[model samples]
Target: MSESKSAGEIRLIRLDRIEVLNPRDRGSRVFDEIVRNIKAIGLKKPICVTPRFDANGAEKYLLICGEGRLKAYQALGEEEIPALVVEVTDEDAFIMSLAENIARRQHHPLELLSGIRQLVDKGYTFKSIAEKTGLAQSYVKEICNLLRSGEERLIVAVERGAIPINVAVTIAGAGDNDKAVQAALQGAYESGALRGRQLVLARRVIDKRQRLGRAAGRPSTTKHSQVSTTTVIRTYQDEVKRQTALVRKAAFSQQKLLLVVGALRQLLSDENFVNLLRAESLTTMPKYLAERVWPNGSHV
Candidate 1:
């Protein structure tokens, strides 16, 4: 340790002597890339730490940031690594760490949550966290609330980009009411966050989950022989053919009906044709047909 240097000075520090105050589970892929970068070009930035002493009066360091860099150094078999030494209170250390995590362009989602959690556990307000991390105060409050309330699934979904944060928040407050969830989906559609195809799929998934009582598909205990891909494709093709035929037949019927309605409307407009129909007592017709033929007047 450089004993004579003031705060914010860079120096070499032994890895064993430093402790990571806010250790996060870095994603393996990201960590491997970090190792490769440091191994290739050396560390671009030094890890930041605050100096302290153990019970035996031996000097030590509490890690403020740069956990990836430190771990990469260890992975490369380096005993000591460079560090940015800072002198600050415990709260200040936590704030600085949060800032560092926020500044990182490629950190894991859970790592972000971990850093925010540490700050919250230290009793910093959401406003303070927002100011330090350059996030909206509402965003800070919402995420911290999720962390405190044990909404782990929602938090992970939002952080990992599986779901929008607002959507998760709506779900969190929805409770056991299906109506609320539906309304939330409606709102997402109105806001253009959920498109038509996504909405259709979402509803189908939700309905399936409700009917089947689970989120994931399981192996069927009452299965017959395995379905061959060729058989499945044949069945699908047959269904498509059947649907196409039905659609064409319905369209042909629609055109015939339109001609019939148009002829009926023209005939009914003539007083002589109307009198003949009345005299023959063939005056009644289906209400829908009547509406199409004589929309304003009631066709007896």
Candidate 2:
């Protein structure tokens, strides 16, 4: 390794010498994108490296950041990559890994969590993690939550770019651990599983399935009571026609009633009818009414 201004600190190294810390950093698509960008525009940000020792008092460099870009450079058969060399402890190295990732925004959800977990396992609390990485406390908690998802498939999905980090965070907190596992494995949940306000409903589906399994052993009393498809259809058709006929009859009756009411209201308002009624009331009844009252006496 070449020594720079500082005697103990190595200044620069080959791109291949730096190692990626997080196992989940297998960024196939991002690497491809980086390669494409490099092909079009070229590398913009330099990678971060830390100092290490080899046998025989020799020095080496371990990559603390820019894993995706490094892979892209490697794919392009790059001769050199700009790097920063610093001497840091194992704990600092772990923090530096996550810090660089947060700074560069290169790691996936799982990779970010895996890096955070390394720092956590190294005795860093959420606060310490935030301070070291310059991330907010809420973001630190979110990263820890992402790591706690525990579903291998979900973790894989996050690594493979199948799901967004925010949705994965929600899925991690949701119930039905088995379904979560299934989602993680399948890279997606079943229909209606991820809908808003439908998580409880999804649980109901699981509950219903379980209830059906329990009922599978009991003899079905409904077997003998079941009607044939043809009989059911015929019965439904007959009922429909009967209801339709009743409706039509009722409609006709309503029309007749309305006509009779209209005729009575017209007669009540007529001047000739009113005068005839007044004359009949003064001991000179209508001829038809007089004949009915005195059937044999008057032929009016």
Candidate 3:
């Protein structure tokens, strides 16, 4: 980016004039800390913003960075907050915001995963994401895998700090094998990676995950269909009738087959019939047919 995009004149911008391009949710505790810190020490740094114009050609500031600080300022009931009015494009501003987030030394696991997923959505490869976020490529790939496979339970548990990322990855790597996942959890507990409530919580999460499957937010409360019991009985009765017809047809076919087989056996028993078949070179028959025709004979 050019210097013009990096550096901008400080200006007091109205809170209403600033539009948050992309809003990221920060944890309440962290936001509280930020608010307290700023309230005590005053605003240490100015927020970054890019000038944007609305359809009415009215000047507006699109927020590029410092969302938490901006929110803190709003929480402080400040009318006009100091902002660095830059000249970067929307895409570049978004990139700068993402870069600012990735540059943080202490990112919450949920935030970290969200950042990596955002970069992946922006068409960055695993290697590129690793480089951009200063994370290992393998770790980035695993994070992406977790997102791709919709491992919502493991992800939510990780977000809530119930389990570490590595343990989650290990359990997820076990695939649908409930036994392997149980073994992994046991190992985690036995190795002191998980203790007491965490181990219990992990086990509970896994059990719920296994029984209820992955959930994004609220669990589904889909009720049974409103079909009447009488309707079900009638449908089942129809199916049974259809099946009975099939069974009757099968029995009739079997009886006819036995009659044919008896006739064939009687014919084969005749020496004159065997001689005629040998004359026509039709002496050989399928092994099944031979077995049916000559039950006691050594057809083999």
Candidate 4:
């Protein structure tokens, strides 16, 4: 039954009649959340569907969005589900479905990869994908290359925020040599693409994979061993060095700041220097320097 034209009246369509156009392999947590939410509060948003007449003159609805909600309803043994019928071509429906998922802030990286791959398969170029999905062209190209090269481990690392995408790309391009992988990791560290715990985790992931002969593109079958004492000592030493460098850098900055403050204070006390600064319109000192030079609210 239809109610209004503007709001796209909600209709109870047969569950089997609606086909999910773009289904994603979401994580269990997301699936469970959907199930829980739907079970507790019922469906909040009605799934969007478009109608297509079958060969037998029977109308079937194609789902544009809400695959998770549809799945939740199915799991609840639902026969008919609420849907909003929209008039659109198949291509438009697909685009709408892609947009709906991609527009979400919490959309999974894997889903984006899959969606991009689908677009590529459907004859969409990198530029077209970027335009349609609102993703950067470089990002689309890189992810597509990763998928093409079968870099599942790197993809997983990127999805988990364990490694930057560019770093992963570098590692993936580094052949099957341990030395090359190590070199890439070093480059990433030097370029500041990786730092601290992320750098450590990346090293571990890469090293573990390399020692077991399972590179980024290769299939992973190696189980990690217990952390060795030597490894622990090495990691601790690296952390100490990093912290020491940071401390030294901070100390140097503080010394420079103190010197600057002292020089500015000395210059401000001189009548000639103060007059020169005023004449040159350079009376405005930095906030930090001003705060220190005029701590008692005295005008300089």
lDDT of each: 0.75, 0.58, 0.79, 0.79
**Clash statistics: count for each candidate:** 1, 2, 0, 0
TM for every model, in the order presented, reads 0.60, 0.46, 0.60, 0.61
> Candidate 1 residues 34-73, lDDT tens each?
9999999999989999999999999999999999899999
Range of the 10 consecutive residues with the lowest summed lDDT in candidate 1: 212-221
State which candidate has the highest lDDT: 3
lDDT preference between candidates 2 and 3, better one: 3
Query: Tens digit of lDDT per residue, candidate 4, span 1-300?
Result: 121224456899999998888876665677888999989998998999989988899999889898988988998899989999887778878877886787567887666666776788888888977887787899778888888887766776776789999998988898676678889999999999999999988987775544433324322223564678996996686677667757977999999988987897787889999898889988786776789778886755
Write the residue-wise lDDT of candidate 2 on 1-300 in tens digits.
122223234344676566766433353455577899987998787776777767766666777677777778888998677776666665556566667675545444445555677777777789877877777787677667656544434444444444444545655565446566346423434443255433444334334322221111222324375679986996686677667757977999888866765664466467788677677874355664455345565322
lDDT of 2: 0.58
Give the clash total for candidate 2: 2
| Lowest lDDT 10-residue stretch of candidate 3 | 216-225
Candidate 3 lDDT over residue span 205-229, tens digit each: 8876665565444322234545789
Model 2 CA deviation exceeding 4 Å by range? 1-12, 102-106, 142-300
lDDT of model 4 at position 90 = 80
* Ten contiguous residues minimizing lDDT sum, candidate 2: 210-219
Mind sharing the TM-score for model 2? 0.46
Model 4 misplaced stretches (Cα beyond 4 Å): 1-9, 208-300
